[model samples]
Target: MASNNRQNSKMTDDGANVTSTPSHDTRQASSSIHVNNLSYDATEEQLYSSFCVCGDIKSVRIITDRLTGNSRGFAFVEFKNTTAVSDAIKLDGMRINGRPVKITVAQPRNSINDNRVVQNREEYQRNTPSRTRVVHCKKSQYDVYIGRPEYWGNPFVIGKDGDRSDVIRKYRAWIMKKPEMLERAKTELRGKVLACWCKPEACHGDVLAEIADND
Candidate 1:
């Protein structure tokens, strides 16, 4: 929240002393906002233009697959202040490219780092042979659901069979359509030590944590 110091003035060639206002450091004032359920074809320009109506954007970063280089159906928009953050929050449940995008303030980088440590620990605990295995449902984008589908275990089959990518895409689309389901998942998962397969970068588990903790 700290800003750059404003400097006192100096006399110019015109013999007038001017006091320069402190410049807003978008980086220092910057806060990240998460945007999910983006259309695969959504462009950075479109995102920038939409959010800029609320505040000056520091940057727009869209997450993409490492190998395929395709949009992961999400992005992080950085804004200059809490006011902009509030403005952007109004965009949540609003349509973007014919689909409603889920918007929330991203967790602090340090908190996310701390989560990695906890996630890894929980992941290890869940994988232990002694613990009872829970159902594996790929129903939501967050991987929270009741029934385990057969495709999940054997996602890579031949001829006409769908792969993991297909499953993820379908799940993302499904959850985006029914955000109530996501809220339900967050409510159910709150306060429990759940495993997070995705770490370091943002993940659905983190989203659930953010929602639950805030509530």
Candidate 2:
């Protein structure tokens, strides 16, 4: 119930605690809204064009399927202030890509799969105005980035199948193995920001945050 605890404390409807991230507290969540019933064909540009009339939008996040990389029929839209939230809500029945969408205030994530990175690093997104806003992996176009999926351990098989988490898992499974690599990671991440990447959306950086976050 403490402030940090509440900000950091997220739980599922069943009451299980899971890793939550930057989407809410990381940005002006008060001005953000959740969008549902999206057409898979909807583009960020289309959503922005639709909602821009309400007010200046901070960002628009369209949820996507990680493995297959397709739209998941939902997204988050953030404006410069809460007033736009009200205006945006009025457009709930508006269509994008020919689908009438449903709109509502955004909610905090309380599931493992709904993961993201923490922003403790100083230089990660330092110059960005909305640096607190988390980013999307594919959207950001990064070859290797930190995020929530890394923390949740979603069966990353390697060479045989998976790769990222698979390598991280094997790191622990063997460190029982390390380059000192584990120690180096800890040292490098010290005194930095936490999950500043794609919020509410899971990322591999989540695992990095957890690892360096611990003793």
Candidate 3:
């Protein structure tokens, strides 16, 4: 059995050290619980079934090795309600398949990059001439920017000169593999016009527009 339980700690906005959460998650600490000292053979399904008895569960993610894809003897479970988090924490220090488990509220990850963004914006503002102006727009309302296909300007497009068919095929395949990107794109493009930097006939932006229109 793998005896070592892998743990990760990160700094939060409040200047406190805490367990790291997923980068894309925006849930509060009360909604997530960390479980450690898990049996090496413990499965996510088993963890779900065990925790679901306390309340509704949203997700169960067992941390694993990036190289070997083996369990790392710890996991993070998110519940649908704060009450469920409280209930789940009650099981801390309890035996699971003969191994005692450690449970606690998962800590929020810090947004250090936000500070850098602010600093860069300030520097740009200070250096800019009065003749230049900046326009701020919501991300969804902003125009899409695609570069020349030969110059690799459009990351979503593949192949030389960026064939439209190839772009669409590649994009569809990419979204299929990354369902989160598809979901986010669907959400961001809602009620917005889709326009790309390149000509409509030459760019793959039409493929994305088609997706948004269908939605």
Weakest lDDT window of 10 consecutive positions for candidate 3 = 130-139
What candidate 1 gets wrong by more than 4 Å, as runs, is 1-30, 111-215
lDDT of 2: 0.63
Q: Which residue pairs in model 1 clash with each other?
A: none
The most accurate candidate by TM-score is 1
- List model 3 lDDT by residue over 1-215, tens digit each: 85355557888999999965344556655788999999978888888988998899999999974423557799999888878988888889977667899998887555686788889988975785432111222333444333345221345545563677777677665545554544444556544554445542445555454444342
Q: For residue 7, give model 1's deviation from the true position in Å.
A: 36
Span of ten consecutive residues with least summed lDDT in model 2: 128-137
For model 3 the local lDDT of residue 189 reads 57
Better of 1 and 2 by lDDT: 2
Q: What is the C-alpha RMSD of each candidate to the true structure, in Å?
A: 14.4, 21.5, 19.0
lDDT tens digits, residues 1-215, model 2?
44464335678999999876456545434688888999988999999999999999999999974433558799999888888888898998998999999999885454543443334334444643431222454454333334435532323344664465565565455432333544554566544444434445444445545445444
Clashing residue pairs, backbone N/CA/C < 3 A, model 3: none
